[model samples]
Target chain A: MEPFRRLAALACPLVEANIDTDQLIPARFMKESRASGYGRFLLHDLRFDAEGAPIAGFILNDPAAADARILVAGRNFGAGSSREAAVYALVDYGVRCVIAPSFGDIFASNAVNNGLLPAVLEEAAFEALTDWMGGAPAELVVDLEARRIAYGGRDAAFSIPDAWRAKLLNGWDDIALTRQHAAAIETFARERLRAFPWVAPRTDGPRGGAQPRSPDAGETRAGGASPQSSDL
Target chain B: MPATLFDKIWDAHEILRDEEGRSLLWIDRHFVHEGSFHAFDTLAERGLSVARPDLTFGIADHYVPTAGRPRIADPKIAGMVERLAGNAARHGVQLFGLDDPRQGIVHVVGPEQGLTLPGLVMVCGDSHTATHGAFGAVAFGIGASEVAHVLATQTLWQTKPKRMRLVVDGRLAAGVTAKDLALHWIAALGADAGRGYAIEYAGPAVEALSMEARLTLCNLSIEGGARCGMVAPDATTLAALRDRPMGPAGADFDAAAADWAALTTDPDAVFDREVTIDARRIAPTVTWGVSPEEALPIDARVPDPAALVSEEAARQMRGALDYMGLAPGQKLTDVAIDRVFIGSCTNARIEDLRAAAAVLKGRRSRVPGIVSPGSTLVKRQAEAEGLDAVFTEAGLEWRDSGCSMCVGMNGDRVPAGERCASTTNRNFRGRQGPGARTHLMSPAMVAAAAVAGRLTDLRDL
Candidate 1:
């Protein structure tokens, strides 16, 4: 993941509230691998019509806003669904920051971890910015180190969880950070098992779990111990 | 200080706490569906293996064909399901594949298989995992990055959400289902009202709800902007858990039930926030616009954007109306629909199926629809009770269990420009399909809409 410090780029406004993940990248587009890149699929349905022609009026489709990398949207932006690809689409499309009044809890987390800044402003402040900018193309400077955004001849502070800011500024991977507490986690697991063994999956209930395909089925392969069968 | 059920659960699961009040809580059960292969990709990228394979369960749902086995005609869709199997097999996680009789939506299969027990932290890759909170669990959804983190560490760092309890008094009026109750509250309070809070449904009305109905309520909590919502364990919860395959049995079950029953919120415990709702006032509600909060009673008309105060709000309302092809002052019942869908984590349990079946019995639908059960077990049981005949005779398709049409990723989708009366939770713009409008309601209400060929009131039917 990229370390986010500061980004100054053209900003586009998506004026609707509750812009959910489905609209970010439709579910159909999620069928392909992420390696294929999702920038083209970002808001595909909203930006295009059934005939696949670009809808001329959509903000993202506007030719002037084509190079925008900062998205300023309505309240509760990125709401609904825990699809991380929504963030991927934005990051892959060169979106460096999303300014909104609020965000879905899961989407906000996904954004931060993927190195996309989900900068939040008060509703009144967001409305003011939208009014000042309207649908016009403008460049906004986002300084993660300073926790401020600069545009329209003035700089304004934005708020993000301090821990998340720390993570992004330092580019700290969550798993690697959590590994420092490995001893505590293992200790808790042992103690928890001793105390509440019944909490585990007791597939031994009346119905009985008779799952097909054993976990150890790999041992039963015929001279296919490794991926070298053809070579042999 | 009196400890709430949430406090107890949090205290028990905390592996470590940081200075910012974020606790690294140990997750007990992790449910994954077809969408989660992305997490597997991340794990491989990081050269990490699943830390606790035994606690993780994989189920095929989002991309599985609803028509029947071997009906996944789209190779891309087939690859999603196949990759889930590949990941599960590679990681040694127990998978309920399509061939398994227990295969279903991850949220439904967890509780159906008794894997969703009280006093545990359950996490899933899909937003509807809150469905498991009905069993007194602290279940919530995570994104693929967090899913990968949890897969690698079996713990999550989260600031403990403030507890908010909605005390709903009075029993629901006849024909008012939990779906209606949830939609009513979400509309009364705006969509973002419950943000940063873990909601607990209390009071007599919540206590009187069936276990399945409680699951339905919690399933829709995310739609209301609450990540986790729960109802305390009672007789209904115990009865739901009894003799299930993934839960404790015999004397152990008895001991577990006693513990679960005692996991209620303490008397005199003050919640961080509290709301009082009169259940009697809730009507059979349906969304009129794209958001869940854009809902009203069945008899109400579409709201005019001109009446809205905020410019931003009015702009959104107008945009939603334009997308939905609805006009202000139009009667909801007069809004005709092209089809109906009756299956999702929100309302696809056995009880949900039975309620829709009761409404559709002998009454052929004027429009086409689909009725997929929550699980294959639910499908077989519904067939045994002749519910399949009810749906088929009414011209609705009888489908095998999966998250069909709800996510719109599979082949099953409401066509472009078509309107559908649905029983799913979220009604976001194009949730069912691009250019497709969705009006969400309860199963019975969906059935009535299918009968009337419009968004008609179930009571009138």
Candidate 2:
């Protein structure tokens, strides 16, 4: 994980929203391991034709956008079913950020968690940015720290809560976040379990059996229970 | 200090705060389906187990086939099923597995089983989890990681979202159902209109809707970019909640009703943003463009990029129109489709099936298509009432349950380059598959279009 402190303008003129997960990474691509180049399949259904041929009409087909790393989309970008492949696709296709008027809720979460900047801008600002990139290379500076997206020599500020932005910039998931509190959590569990033995698992040697286990062992076993539902 | 309905509910559910200051909101109910096995695996690897599995419930949906075999033969799918059972048993969570009469799509079973109670906060790893919000719950879909978090600790650390009240007044005209209203709202609100907000679909039109109709409204909340969409619970909601497996029993029912009555917003409350739509103005809308919000009435003409406000928009619109095989200025009804698919979380319930069957009873599909029920129960009930016969006789395949052709998760998919009139959400270019153009429509409208072999308006039929 690295601090996202820099701003670089990388723009693609294409504007499309409600881009589903399948289009981000088609179902056929999931057959491959996540360790493989799943990013290559990003926009598999959109960037290529049935025979894996490039569709000239597709926005990604334009020669100018060949190296573009940022995409500007219309309202409601990333709608439909929750498949994380869409983020993989965008990231794999060299897009690190997507600027749109709006994004699907699930899609936005996937983007943030996967370290993709899904910046929501005003409709007019989005349009203006894309319009500026119509002929020349579209440019936008995404400063994760400042929470601003500058385009066309003019910057538009947006806010993504500091915590969420930090998680994305650092590439840390929930597990990483939980690890940060592991020591404190462990102590809290040990203390709470000793005080509330009823909720803790019993470690008493099966009835009156001569089991060679310490009494505190059973106490700690039951005390190990975290304050969360285990599964379903 | 006027609190929006969303904040009121969010505040009520706050259990504690973590060191990072994120509010640990208590989750009243947790829903899961077959696709969430990965989350369970992640938990196992961490030497952790579900702490309060009793609140967790599992249903067999998503990957389950609608027909062919009662049990899946695919080793991976079978393994996933076994994992769900094993996980539920080990964690002490209740599961409604396949063959259980209560087994159905997660979204379908939630309401029918009375598990999605009003004022409760419901979370599922599935996007359509918003379907539970129809009961006036703070229902929303979470990610697999979040799902694991909830399973381990019946709570989620979340920043509270703002609220928006979409008041659709006036009565709906004939042929326009809740599906139509939702589609209209998504189109009018520009698909992402509800972003970062929880939307309460209120007003006379919402209250007048049946429980099933309300579910359809909330099911598409994710499609319109809202965290969740809900309607205030009323007598209709209470009546529907009755007789379900987990519904309130005996005197507990009366107590629950009193609490449910208070779930609604105050007479005068402020919203982060408000958008009003005239119910009467909406018709049996059909999407002609590539996005749900880009839809137009059947009578409306295909949009011309030149007429757009921005050059960027014009270019994108031009591409969408070209990809859709629709020319500018062409009537939406004039667009012919190669196939029709009417099944998905968006519109795959019993009522949706019945509505489509009613339109296709004496008719026949002009193209090859299938009418997949959302679940085994929906398929059984449809067959029990002869809805299957109507579909089969009309040249439409009456397949088994599961999300078929919606996202092409399974083998069922539309061929590339073929245009399809689908009742499922999203009309993004090639959303069905590569080269497969999709046009979103209501179930009845999809049936009408299937019979006509094109995008024909239900009004004309």
Instruction: State the lDDT of candidate 1 residue by residue for A149-188, as single tens digits.
Output: 8887977889998888988898878899898999999999
In lDDT terms, which candidate is top? Answer: 1
Model 2 scores a C-alpha lDDT of: 0.73
Clashing pairs in 1: none
- Show where candidate 2 strays beyond 4 Å: A1-3, A7-18, A53-75, A91-96, A99-101, A120-142, A148-158, A169-232, B17-21, B71-92
Restricted to chain B, the TM-score per model reads 0.98, 0.95
Model 2: how far residue B66 lies from native, Å = 2.3
Worst 10 residues of 1 chain B by lDDT: B377-386
Q: Of the true contacts between chains A and B, what fraction does model 1 have? A: 0.57
Q: What TM-score number comes out for model 2? A: 0.84
By DockQ thresholds, what CAPRI class is model 1?
acceptable
